[model samples]
Target chain A: MTARRFLSDLSLTVCGLAVLVFLLLPVLVVAPMSFSDAKSLEFPPPGFSLRWYQSLFGSDIWVEAGINSLVLATISSTIALVCGTLAAYVLTRGAFRGRRLLEANFMAPMIVPAIITAVAHYIAFARLGILGTFHGLVLGHTILAVPYVVLIMQAAIRGFDIRIEQVAATLGASRLTILARVVLPNLWPSAAAAWIFAFVLSFDEVVVTLFISGAHLTIPKRMFAELIIQVNPTITAVATLLIAFNLLALAVLLLVSRRGRLFERGY
Target chain B: MTLPGSYESGPVASQTVAAAHDVAAEATAVPARRRASLRQWELFFLLLPMLLLIVLIFDLPILNAAYWSISDPKTGALTLGHFRDFLDSTAYLRIIWRTFFLSLEVTAATILLGYPLAYWATKLPPRWRIVVLGLVVTTFWVSILVRTYAWIVILGSAGLINRLLMWAGVVSRPIEFLYNEFGILVGMTNVLLPFLVLPLFAAMMRVDMRLLQVAETLGASRFRIFWQVFFPLTLPTLAASAILVFILSLGFYITPAVLGGGRVPLVANMMDLLINRFARWETAAVVSVVLMVVTLSLYAVYQWLREKNA
Candidate 1:
């Protein structure tokens, strides 16, 4: 490379690294600060302690909220996975009129702002008298999460070949039998990724949860409430833990998807 | 389940009418023999649970919100007065405007900062490229709540920057970095950066470096080649991420609330105020309708642009 080109490349690399530093800044501060012995927000702690983690795990509200989030995410994402995968299968495999329109309608929830959905739930759940109920949250989150499931499965189905199912049909296998024995096995990896995607999306959701859920707290709602209610160090500790949890999840996903080569084409 | 003629009656009776109507109408044009193979009924059964979930959970409830926006409390009659009330309020109008501009600013910032980083990753060796891209993708899995909390720990008055500044004797007192417009932007941009980068990185991978080589051979300066060739190639992804980030940022409630210290009232916060605090469902619904229209229309534009470009 020429001197001028080398100089320009050096400057670009420096600037890029600076941006990466900026990206890493939050995680750096939050993780270490969680280990601080200070009762409040302090940096470069005079001493270290596990008080915040103890607080996070020891508190009933935090534990309950965590459990609430897990249960809701589990139920909703499972519903979304089954419903959305079926929808995608039909959209991709079945010859039908207005298929494009159906696909668009299915994809709509992903783009629609969450607040609108939240307000919608606020009204519907109130009327159903399921407001603050776990089932109500499951209903709302399932709606929010289905679009992701459908979109992911749609991509997966488009890449898939239907010859196996056709061959199975020619062999006198029933449609249900073919679907169970052929199509689903072919789609399992995508299905797994989509399930995890839906689960994580629903887990991270807050705006709609705030509206539909009252008294019952999810992790995000609790964290949001805590941040607004008081700037607590425990929240930082909680955030650190959540970050660690998410990183672990991402690693697991990367491992699974790499083995399956699921995201080789572009997410 | 037996024949194409038996298409209408199902659990997802809502969309079934529309699909069955289409099928029947098309069936008349075709011969009875081909119609026997019609799978619209099977399709209907396949799509039933999903259709029902969407209708009952998402579609109906939103329609209800829209209904509550106009229904009069006394006689339960629909009216346009609620919309007028929303339009008449200058405070609400300003909040909406501020929300738009804040989102615009954040989106612009993300693009400006993220483009270079994404482009740089493309220039890196394959080994380094994976590392950088891995960092960017991993950031996505982190929840917004956790990221925002991280921002608080960093930006707090007694936090990292302030303490460092004080220790360096840069100032007598700590800067009030948290609970301001500046903090809100920093926190939002941090959380939103990964979104902008991943898309751009994906787009950048498709960029043909041979074109740049061709430009280099054709006597184009490096700056000229990048500005005239490389930049334009990536513009579509830039546009896509920009619109996406802006729309997502517009609906943001947590980061701005915690960082803005309730000082900056975005539309979502205002929506919260109207519905939760003041119990003004009509006004909140009107705001939601407005938000939905704007968000969806922009998304429509995004889809159209992608298709047009495609």
Candidate 2:
């Protein structure tokens, strides 16, 4: 029995290590390929060079697309955060008829297949004369992203004790004052989390963007177009940079929410 | 001194008058407090923008898609020809089968590997557990495009694995790893594994460690304790994660498109081809409708079973 148990444990460890390597190998491969000296995608590099990184920086299309992605993500995420927080506040604090229905509506976007949503948006926006515009893209992405913000904020609000707000109101504070001073401070971690999540959702979004984006090009859309037209190492450089940026964002989020125990709660 | 009938009548009328006055006062006070509570209507008013945006953007678009699926483009009349075309074709049927099987394979792989990792995580110290889980969830936040691209770089001809194998004399020739079903499976599994792990970890954490200790004291072997006590409790989470992964995998397009290199076709890829290549919007809409119905039915079944058990 002891020998069998030992063998099983050993096997489990081996399996775990193999899985980890599988997860990490692709990421590991890209980091070096981004620095390859050759113009073409060849492994065991003929030599080492940073020409791809230089090309990535020098290209006007790449620069414009990067700026476009950042602006769209930032504006859309902020809009989502504000709208979602308001909806979350209403859901948590206000008593109204059909509250359950409203909550379900907020959640529907997240649960429904995103492809269906993308297709629908494509058809609707095309007819409305807004297709391919930055405004259309931002509006579409905000709708896609707001549900995440609402979800996180709802969880955050559940942990809050309402009695504190009641006490502030009883102590002669106005409703707006209490919200601004007491509620907002306590809700910061969730709000920050929601904002970050919204930003990432917008940044990473491709399917919906593919449908609505006409002349406007975001980073993902540009990369996709390039992939179909030609194979280039610039994409590897861009991907490496994105990975770094995501890691940075994750680190910052962890630092801010460490004390709040936000990661412990599941969405 | 007074007459008995007159004195009794006066006292009875006075009591009745006082009771009527008290009832009117209570009714007036109730509405006043209700009016005061109505002051909080601002919250709902604040929620209006979000509601309107969702209605216009999300609700209307989906309804349009459904309508378009039924509307015939050529005849300008409502018809079911697109649906019939999709259902009748052997090519489409095969594509659907391949998509379903690949998604199932990926889901199974994710669960088989993710479950043990989650279980092991529960045995670690709390701080280490958080860090490890953080790493897993962080992977979830990485863009799917980036991850898929990374896989391409690793699996391409003369890529990392091939190069390493050749250097180590493991094989004489580079293997055809990319642009195949095997590549899609590998990439999709990596992309979906984090989704499985998070939910499973949550489920595993709910199983009380003390219960396992009790089993140990009762002379059950460690393996038996795990199977009889731990595994049964985590079954619901396992089921939930499997459904989530499977459904998400069904709609997956990027990894398959990049790695499959046009050999393997999924429902999403079919939709793309119909719309872009064939300019057949009606056919694309039909395919989308089918995908939606399949996903929703599976979801409904899962929910019904869960509710019945509850």
Candidate 3:
């Protein structure tokens, strides 16, 4: 019985370790391949070089796409933050009928599949004659980003003490003033986390952007297009940078939320 | 008490009754009633901009798609031609069926792999548990496209796996692992694994350790204790995440497009082709509505399971 138990435990550990490797395989493989000297997708590289990184930097299209991705993510995430934060505050604090229904409406963009959103946006934007416009792209990305912001901010607001708002109101502050001052200032850490979440979401969005973005290029969109056509070593460099960027964002979020214990308070 | 000759008392008696009513209102629910209305208005104004944006951008487009699916695009006449086109075509049905089965396969794969990993994590020391789960989340944060792209390197003809196999003489030639159903399955299972693992791990942690201890003390074998107690407790979460993975897989665009190399066009890729490649807006709208309905229905079930577990 003892020997049998030992065997089972060993096998379970081995299986668990194997699955972890599988989960991390892409990240493990892609980062090293970016530094490979050989042109092909060779593992245990014959030699190490930074050629792919150099090529990625040298390419004008890549540089342009990077700028576009940054701008698009920044603008959309900011818009989502503003609109979603106010909506979240209302949804959490307001005594109103149909609040649940309205909250669902805000979250619908997230629950509905992205491909459906892509097709819907494609047809609607085409009919409105804004299919290829940057404004249309922003709108599409913002809709996707809004739900995350709403989710995060709603949780944060719910975690906040309502008595504080009542105290501010008792001090003769207007509703908007209390929200702008007492409420939002205390919720900045979560708001920042939500913004970063939305930013990463927009930065990585592909399906909707593919459908509606006529001439505009973002990193994921470009990488997707290139991937479907061919594999390039330069893509590994871009992928590595994206991995680093996302990890950095995640680290900042963890640090910010840890200091605030934003998640621990039910977020 | 009733006022005497109130009907005939004219303005004097009426003023007295009004004053009584005002005093009663002030003594009772009037302040709260007024505050509730005021708060509602504030909330309304706060919620308005987001409502308008969602209605105009998100809801309107979806409603527009539904309209397009059922109406004549050029003349705006109500017709069933688009949906009929979808229903009558075997090609569309074939792709839909293929998407269903592939999503099922991916869901099953994730559950099989994820269940063990989550279970194992539950048995680990706290520090190591965090390390293992952290790796899973870090992978989750990586781009789906980047992860999908990585598979081509690992599974391509001259890729890592093939090279390793050739070196060991495991096979005489490279097995074709790209641009097919097998490749799609592998890429998708890898991409969606974290979704299942994270939630399952949390649920596993929530399973009571005392129940296992009790079973063990009662002379339940290790296998019996786990199978009867621990696994059953975590089943709801496992089932919930499996549905989520299924729902996500049904609409997968990137994996099938890049890894499948257009050979196995899932519903998403098919929609992409209908709209972008062929400019068949009405047909794409029909496909969208169908996929949306299927996904939402499954999501409702997923939510129910989650609520049940909670």
Task: Give the winner by TM-score: 1 or 3.
Answer: 3
Sliding window of 10 residues with minimal summed lDDT for model 3 chain B = B1-10
Residue B43, model 1: Cα distance from true site in angstroms: 2.2
Q: Can you rank all candidates by lDDT, best first? A: 3, 1, 2
lDDT tens digits, residue span A127-240, model 3: 899999999999999999999899888877887766556655655567899899878887787888899989999999999999999999999999998998889989999999
Model 3, span B1-310: residue lDDT tens: 0000100223643454455554444444435677667777887888888988899899999999999999998999999988888899999999999999999999999999999998898889977877887777778889999999999989999888999999999998999999999999999999999889888888888888999999999999998998999899999999999999999999999999999998998999999999988999999999988988898899989989999889
The CAPRI quality class of candidate 2 comes to acceptable
Error of 3 at B177 (Å): 0.9
**TM-score attained by model 2:** 0.89
Q: Pick by lDDT: which candidate is best? A: 3
Please give the C-alpha DockQ score of model 1: 0.39
- Runs of candidate 2 with Cα error greater than 4 angstroms are A1-3, A42-46, A171-178, A259-263, B1-32, B35-40, B74-76, B301-310
| lDDT agreement with native, every candidate | 0.81, 0.78, 0.87
Q: Candidate 1, TM-score vs. the true structure?
A: 0.91
* Residue A123 lDDT (model 3): 91
Question: Model 2 chain A — which ten-residue stretch has the worst lDDT?
Answer: A258-267
lDDT of 1: 0.81
Error of 1 at A39 (Å): 1.3
Query: How far is B273's C-alpha from truth in model 1 (Å)?
Result: 1.1
